[model samples]
Target: MKKILVVFLVIFAGAVQAQEVLQAGFKLLENGQFAEGAAFFKHYLTTQDATNKTALLCYGRGTGLSGNVTEAKEVFGKLLQRYPGDFEISLNAAEALMWCKEYAEAKRYYEKLLTEKPNDFAANLGYANALASLFEYEKALVFTEKALQIQPSNDNAKLSRKYARLGLADYFVKNQDYHRAAPLLESILSENATDKEALFAKAQLYIQLERYNEAEKIYQQLLQLTHGQTEVYLNLSYLSFLQANKPLAFEYANKAVESTATQPQKYLTARLGRITALGWNGKFKQAFAELDSLDSVFPNNNDLLIKRAGLSIWNKEFAHSVSLFKKSLRNVPSSFDGNLGVADALFAQELDDESKKYVLKTLEYYPNQKDAKDFLAKLALRHAPALTTHNFISSDKGGNASKNYQANVAFDVATALRFNVGYRRREVSNSLENNSANVQTMTAGLRWRVKPFWLITGAINVTKLEKDGAVAPFKTFDIASEFRLNKFQTLELRHNSDVQSFTAGLVGNQLSFKNYIATYNLSTPFKVGVYSQYYYTKNSDGNTRNLLFASLYYDLKATPVVKFGINYQRMTFEKRMSRVYFSPFLFRSYEVFGVSENLNVPKQKFLYQVSVAGGMQRIEDEAYQATYRASLTLGYKPSANIELTAYSLYSNSATSSVVGYSYSETGIKAKWILLKKQQY
Candidate 1:
């Protein structure tokens, strides 16, 4: 009887100790101290059965939520293995694997759990997350919906659904179905305005659409949230560069570089931004120097190699660009940018046949590549009889700030014969009068390649300028003979009976000048060219004028991507041209110096040009005015065949022609290829 009493006492003590440990763990978890609770649960489990359901549940939940995912996965995995029939253990293990990105195994456990409790919200959310990670969006969404129905206020269920939608959106983005991706992202943002991933995605889409204002707003929001995200700053810098705000571009790029010290990937991307900003700012040597250092640091970085190739292309170093692109391809053979770079570099060298395969390859990867498609359209016109059409807003000029929108269609009936038709609408605004005038010009033309290397093209434009109680009728005729000296050289002589253009923010046809122009362009194997033009004009009063322009251009080794030129003119005007606009070209003779550069931002589907010209303008008889002008133009191509360009020009003495006073002009031009002939 005494021995029995001692045994009962021992059993009671053991039971009390087990209760104490369990209560301690539970109490620790109640205070949300997961690490401490997990340790207590682990200690309690060591003194009990390995498959104790209550102990396993406490241990797994505590371990998983304590940020110990790997060890938690091991604990839950062992629990499931030992207690194969335990429903709770299986569910936690499945979620643990899902969090750990072991999707296949997670799905297996989830399947087992679902067969037992089909409508369990936790099971459904975990399964949906696993499926979404595995790219099974459709299945994921079904499970997510079920989870939400079971627990409408569950944050995890909502997040699971969001992830599933994002998975589909990602697929749509890859397929170039931005229309589909857009609403998905917008929906997510509407639900959670502070969602960083959704905001970043939205910002990127805005950038792609060339909506800089909207993109800037989004990026600024992101920046306010966290100053440490370097990519956001880098992208802002690129945006500033695109808008010709070089100072802001440099600032943001520098910020991007300084924002991170430990993240290698962000450092490399920020370095790319710095290089691009410097190049745009005309600091090519500095940009190239940075490139060399970046290359040494991130030697096998495909993006670095591709960026170098693109920079080379901008510099007009075609062969060097090709070499860099090849090196990039060696790292990523299927790289879309690498293939496109090779094609563009080859095209710049006038190697059409060799570039064809690369263009085709680019199309294979991204069929919507605008540059490649435009090049292909040009190629089709070159090699076979094809039809092509273009609508370009082209450029803007003057104090009145004239805008010309021209659309043209051409049909190559044969290799030697082509017919073309076009329409142009010109708008001019008078700021002082607060009035606007429009001119409608209808045009038709033809091209006849009389010789294999020689061609003649002629066009006639009938202009009807209707404004404030005045309807003026005018006819302009232009004809040109193009002599293709060799594959990459051309000499053209053009005559214009009356051609309309803008001068000093005013009407170019105010005097309807007759122009005789000769242009000669020569490209050498060294990949540079000389472009020279000489023109003589006689105004309506029959007084003649002479103008000469000469420039050395780099087609394929141009650093800073510029063409610098000098112009000299000797003109005695028979009469002063017009009323609303002003001109500094008042004297008989003038000399001007200028530089221009066009840049196509790599991978951005955007092109922009910046020009600065300064000269001595003869305003009064024997009187000279010091004049300077600047212009910025940005363009976007939505597809291979469609392009839109917006431009702003400012000149006191710049964009179209030097003037006596400050003039600002802004306009938009849209171009579309209505017809393309494919040799293939």
Candidate 2:
């Protein structure tokens, strides 16, 4: 009996020591030292009873939390087989399903567990987490609330709830249901004021709603919360981009790149942001260099390809842009940037038909996408029929006056062809000469695009002229062609045969002339431009003339575009006809001009242009005379399809058939689109 007591004490002490070790392992796990707890349990189970249930359970959980999910599942599997129907074992086994990423199976098991024990906090929280993992955010949110009700202060349950709300809000935002998404995010921030995900969602939603100021405030808040992190800086850059502040966008993007020195995933995203900002600021060389560096690190990435494609477009490399976008499409067939980018590049190349195909394809992947819809609308406008009318009256310093009325209708008969018709009526009078004339003309024209970059336009005109109680009818024709040499260069050749009718003396004399003109223009990305025109005229009165006009200009400001320029003109006649007209042996003029206009200002309802020029002109080797010219136009677009404009101009640059002529004209014009939507 004494020997039995000794063995009992020895066995009891050994059991107590094992219990202490198990408690120590459990305490480590409870303290969230997952790897340490897992190592402790691993060594304890090797020499101890392998069937120790409590120790095995703690071991499984510790291993799972320590990222050894596969081994955790194996341990839990054996435990469930050994102790079937034990609720604690069953719960841990179900949780092991989640750790193994078998979310669907875990969801089913948790649902069963919930039905058996509705109030069990662990089961409720586990089910919620499984639902969240499956992206069933609505159900996850419901179960998360249930878990919270059971254990109101459970931190894990609250965190699960926060993420579930984030997922739901993102879903709503994806569907453009801002009203529903806003409140969900606001609720999260209301509780946890510094929730990063919620703040980002809120800022993005604000951007979508075009509340840029609010979005900016949110970004500033995130910047403070993150303490100048890469992600917040990148988002701030995006927000600035949306506001059309390219400089600010580039500044923030630089900050984002500087915030991280390592090549992590976030760093990759930050680099992309910097590339985009550089592109926006027209720094293509730097953008391309950055892109190349990034590609060496992460080859064939869709994001990089998209950025490269965009930079190619900006650099006017349309074919390269198309190729790059196609590469991106090969990677992500449904990528919005790929489809829309191809559409834009093709459009830039003047392949409108092919462009329309990609535009429709973009809509196929993203229905009701605003940018795609807007592009379609713009295409429709190009194909739609339009009508415009101009009316003006003028009096010159030479006692010559005129009133003119013109109306034109243009319709796109085909993708590359447009048909146009116009009518004009003019009445001219000279008080000093005691002469008057009335001229009426009807014109029909066709503009054919011979190639994507070349166009040919021809027109025939029938005119009836009545001057000094005599009426004469005649016919005229014009043919012109234009070549878009490249993005920065253009050339045009034009020939027209018409009767001169601008002045009463010319109308009375019935002067007819044929004019041939060659025009060339060069535009530089540096905001400078050069335009030159050469004109050759043959007259029925057995006289010929040659003229040259050129202008060099620079854009001082882009928005409300302000420009300053110098103009030079020289003209010579084969035979002087000072008696019949103001035909001079030689004429020359030089001028300095300034122009300010807001016609290109986007979303501007009121448009205007104000131009003024002053110069000196010489006639027939005579002394130079001072000349002045000015023009103003104010326009209003009450609707998308209708525009009204009032304009006035005055120039003393010898623009009439009389010598030293000072000319002025004022007019109101109206343009109307027959339909906003294309019929065909």
Quantify all predictions' global Cα lDDT against the true fold.
0.70, 0.85
lDDT of 2 by residue, 1-680 (tens): 00000000001245547687577776677677888988888888888867777778777888888889899899988988888887777788888788778889999998898889999888888888888888898998898899899989977788888888888888777777889999889999999888888888889899888899998998899888888889889888988877777899999999998888743558888888899898878788888998989899898789989989988998888888999999899999999999999999988866778888999999899876767877787676666889999999988877789899999999987888899999999999889988889999999999898786898999999999998689989899999999989878999999999998877788877889999999999988788999999999999999999999999999877776899999999999999987777778899989999999988675568989999999899887689899889999999987667889999998878843355577778999999887644432
Best by lDDT: 2
Report the number of clashing residue pairs per model.
Answer: 11, 0
Best by TM-score: 2
RMSD of 1: 13.0
Q: How much is 501 displaced in model 1, in angstroms?
A: 25
Q: Which stretches of candidate 2 lie over 4 Å from their true place?
A: 1-185, 209-214, 238-246, 262-265, 290-302, 427-438, 466-474, 504-510, 577-582, 638-642, 656-660, 673-680
lDDT of 1 by residue, 6-64 (tens): 00000123544666647777667667788898888788778775665666677777887
Off by over 4 Å in 1: 1-82, 92-112, 174-179, 261-265, 296-302, 334-336, 350-385, 388-530, 533-680
